[model samples]
Target: MTTESDVAYAHQPGGLLKGKVAVITGVGAAGTIGAVTAAIFVQEGARVLAADISGAQKETALSLGPAAAPFQVDITREEDVEAMFAHAVETFGRVDILVNVAGNPGGRRGPEVTVEEFESLTSVHLLGTLLTNKHAVRVMAPAGGGAIVNFSSAASFNIDERISMAYSAAKSGVNSLTKSVAVLHGAQGIRANAVAPGFTLSKKNHRVPPEAMKELGGKAALGRPGQPEEQAHVAAFLTSDRASFVTGVVVPVDGGWSARLA
Candidate 1:
């Protein structure tokens, strides 16, 4: 697999994010969007603070380099989210970007789904994102401004086919938050945007049978699902100065899956 380092970036400078400080959430496991984004930011010369609810985040952040630090945080908890931002400021001096990528995957609801199940999904995806973004906005306001790149999903716009109703609703909430932040904070120098991905190749989805991957790709207009790096590339651009004029938009990195015929 050709890495980002191997490919020379032509759109902006070679290191688009040099001297920037970034805080990325939802990096519990390796190869996830959060983990991948953290690595990409590091590679692009940005210091990263990777946080997650799980402890595995330490290993993931450590793998990146000294500039990457890991913290255990639950975005649903305000204290934890606050601490995450404070930790970033204390360690990196200041924060310039935030990638709200922390979320759960097991949103499949059964006929007898409990309230706890519904709340669990909502709190993790929607509420958690709000909390993190809220703090990021507060911390960034006094610092002039910053960039916030959120993770949405194609499920927010159409049927998930996977039938994660709670997840879809939560992600839709995320889209709203993204736009709201962009509109309200652009005057303050903050650029907020989202990336909606469909069937990306991640640690979770890679477990699906190979034939299933092929089937998923066949459903998309691009004849393929997606790669984590492909999605991360878009994220990097959104958070970088190259996207200085882009805000309040949810760009789909789903290989046209969002545009397929129903």
Candidate 2:
């Protein structure tokens, strides 16, 4: 049911990521940033392993053509994360890039936020980033270096009532972890960075009423919410060799929302 138009983005691929093998997480849904990123990566001539916790990723990957393959993985699990990278290596020969986009939303705040809720969000966002980055380093270091793009959030940089303390804290941890990887592995030729996106009209946000969504998006200086492709384009740039000197940085693809907060 996913037509080309459903996942289309304005892109003229000039092999920005040519001859690379990438593993992208959270690529299950058709209209998600992850899925769109996979499509763009393929268009840029990178073979991709489109991974997610959902079986839908199989179909999502298939839609991107023969250069993409799907793998089901729970990024929070060490075994699953290991297998994910292993599968990528087995399928594509090596991992030249990793884009960790799998994450759950967090909204509970104040004293009402339960311990379980905090743990769940941290496990998925923070711990998941840790595990993926750990394994990716294992692959990249041995292979003479690679690039990693971890998905953070605008919540990490600003105080937003719409975001939970746990989510913000986890993403903050992601920023630190990303910096640690860059500092520790830069000499090994590995580059690690993060993308912090603002309110985006991804499939998950479609449930919000149009009026409410418009109000939320209005918070950005751009007066609009971002699109999945907008975020994907940045990820591709960071993962590509064009960004060879860019590492340990958290780029905000928030339509000047963070600047507005500043």
RMSD in order of candidates = 5.0, 6.4
lDDT of model 1 at position 169: 80
- Candidate 2 lDDT over 1-262, as tens digits, reads 1124322421334888878899999997898889989999999889999999989899999898899999999999999999999999999899999999998988688667789999999999989999999999999898889999999998898778767888899999999999999999999889999999999988889898988898889988999999999999999999987777799999999988999735
Judge candidate 2 against the unseen true structure and give its global Cα lDDT, from 0 to 1.
0.90
Give per-residue lDDT, candidate 2, residue 237: 93
lDDT (Cα, 0-100) at 243 in candidate 2: 77
Worst 10 residues of 2 by lDDT: 1-10
Query: Any idea what lDDT model 1 has?
Result: 0.86
Give the TM-score comparing model 2 with the true structure, all chains together.
Answer: 0.93
lDDT of 1 by residue, 146-257 (tens): 8999999888888855657777888899999999999998888898999998888888887889887898877678898788888888988888877777899999888888
After superposition of all CA atoms, the RMSD between model 2 and the true structure is: 6.4
Which of the numbered candidates is closest to the native, going by highest TM-score? Answer: 2
Query: Stretches of candidate 1 above 4 Å error?
Result: 1-12, 109-113
